[model samples]
Every structure is written in structure tokens, then in C-alpha cells.
Target: MSKAEKTKQHIIEKTATLFNTKGYISTSLSDITQATGLTKGSIYGNFENKDEVAIEVYKYNAGLLGKTLSRSFSDEYPKALDKLHAFVDFYRKNWKFVFSNGGCPIMNAATEADDSFPALKNQVKKSFELWMSKISTAILEGQKKGEIDKRVNAEQYASLFIMLIEGGILLSKTMGDQSFLNHALDKITHMIDHELNILPS
Candidate 1:
């Protein structure tokens, strides 16, 4: 990448970690400058303001989550159901990272920006819709392949799954018990396996 692009990326990366740790409003322009080792003028040369840097940081954090989910889905699992399980398993295993880095970006953005920033609130909403769509698509594909029950509602299940996972993550972070996340995942996987099965007793 060019020098400008590299500097921009460096700023984004550093600021993302800070935002995740200190939050948007809590983190100031001076904080960004300190973390990036850049002066106020240099920081402004790369970003318009704290809001601009925050937006980029949010995108960067969300991209990290997206990459994790994508890798889980792309693993060498033989069945779509297995791939879906892997998706949940990945989150369960990485609950520490999720919570430590200021919890899920979607959750953080939803709570922090919903009442303050319209643009950021919209971004969070879009991110959730995209995630739900992906899970729904996978469930539909599994059903079509005879790996899941045709009677099941992919969209509804997807929504429920996301809600449960996000809620579980929130509670785990709040309670300071990572096991809460694992337990939630276990229950979610059980429900999916049972609800989406076609085999008869």
C-alpha cells in the first residue's frame, strides 16, 4: 500500500483497539494521537475527527468478527450442519476475545450509538441484518440438501440464534463467567440439531 494508505491503516488499527477498550466517547483525540504516535495535525491529516476515526475503528472491529465467522464456515466440515456448529463453537471458544475487546461490536454499537449517532446506529443495524441473512441462507441450504427439516423456518431460527448468541455473550461479559457463553452455545446447538432433523425415531 501507499504511504498514506499505510498510515491510515495504522491509525485505524491502533484506534480500533482503543475504542474497543475505552469506548468511543471515553476515548479522546489525544488518546488516539498517543496510541498512534502521531500529532494532532498528523491524526487530522488521516481522519477528519474523532467521529471519523471511530467509524473506521468500528468497521475494523466488525471486520475482525466477520473474518472469524467466515473462517469457521469455510472449514473442512463435510456437512452444512457441521459448519453451522463450527460457527457457534468458534464463538464459544473465543468468548474471552469477544468480551475483552469491549464485547461484541454490534452489541457495543447498538447500546452506545442507538441514541446518539444515527449513522452508527444504522451501520449496526445493517451489520446485524447481514449476519442474520448469512445464517438463514446456510440453514435454507441445509434444508434443501435434506440435512435439515423442511418444516423449520430458516429466518426465524436465524434470528433466534443470533439473539441468543448475542444475549449470551452480553450476560457472560456482565457476569464475568465465560462458562455462560459455552452453556448458551450448548443449548443453542442442541436446539438446532433437534429442530432441524428429519430422522424419525
Candidate 2:
């Protein structure tokens, strides 16, 4: 990468962590500068303003999530059921990072940007849709392979899984208890298995 691109990526990485920890509203320009060790002029030179940095940080955070999910699906788990398990396992292992200081960036941005920033809110919504679509596709694939019950509705079940996960994460964060996540995962796993006509082991 070029120097400018490298610097821009550095700024985005630093800001993403800050935003995830301190929140978009709470993370100030000073925080970004301090974290990045860049002056106000340098920060502005790279980004137009705090909002611009925040938007880029949100995208960076989303990209990180996508990469993690992608890495979980390897050739060893080519089957849809195995792929689904891998996806859930990824979240289970990374619960700490996923539910860090400020919680899910998508949820945070969705709530904060709704009335304040429509454009950012739209991006958050699109990210959610993408997640749901992926899960739905997996369900459909499993159904085709006879691993998942053909009677079950892929889109509906996918929505349920996503909603349950997001809700569970929020609840876990609010209660400051990781066990909530375990319970939530248990419920979701059972739901998926039951829908697939398989008893949960």
C-alpha cells in the first residue's frame, strides 16, 4: 500500500477500536488523535471530521466481522450443517471481543444513527441484511442437502437466529454476565437443530 493508504488504514484501525470501546458519541477527535498519536491537522488531513472517521471505523469493524466469519468456513466444514456450527462456534469463542466495551458496532450505530444520521443508519441496516442473507443461504443449502428439514422456512429461521443472537448479545452486555451468552447460544442451537429434525446433543 502507498504511504497515504497505509496512514489512512492506520487511522481507521485505531478509530475502530476506540469507537468500539468508547462509542461513536463518546469518542472525540482528541481520543482519535491520542490513540493514533497524530495531530489535529494530520487527522483532518486524513479524514474530514469525526463523523467521517466514525463511518470509516464502522466499515472497518464490519469488515473484521466478515473476515472472521469467512475464516470459520473452511474446506473441512464444507457441509452446510458443519458450516453453520463453525459460524456459531466463531461467535462463542469471540464473545469477549464481540461484546466488548461498547457492544456490537452495528447495534450501537443503528440506535445512535437512526435520528441523527440517516446515511450511517442505512449502512448499518444494510450490514444486518447481509448477515441475514448469509444465514438464510446456509439454511437453504442445508435443506437441499437433507441436513436441514425441508419443511422449515430458511428465511424465517435465519431471521430468528439473527434476532436471537443480537438480542442475546444485548442482554448479556446489559447484565454484565457472559453466561447469558451461553444460554442464548444454547437456545439458538437447540432451535436450529430442532428445525432441522435433529435432536440436540
lDDT tens readout by residue for model 1, 1-201: 999999999999888878977876678998998999999999889888888888888888888898778765564775768778888888967877777778898888778887787777887888898888878888888888899899989899888888888888888888988777777798778876778766632
Give the C-alpha lDDT of model 1. Answer: 0.83
TM-score of each predicted structure versus truth: 0.94, 0.91
Provide the global lDDT of candidate 2 against the true structure: 0.80
**Per-residue accuracy of model 2 over 98-193 as CA lDDT, tens digit each:** 876467778878777887877678779889888887878887887787778788887887788777777888888989988877877887777766
**Backbone collision count in every prediction?**
0, 0
CA lDDT of each prediction against the hidden true structure: 0.83, 0.80
Worst 10 residues of 2 by lDDT: 192-201
* Highest-lDDT candidate: 1
Report the alpha-carbon TM-score of model 1 versus the true structure.
0.94
The candidate that achieves the highest TM-score relative to the unseen native structure? 1
* Clash tally for model 2: 0
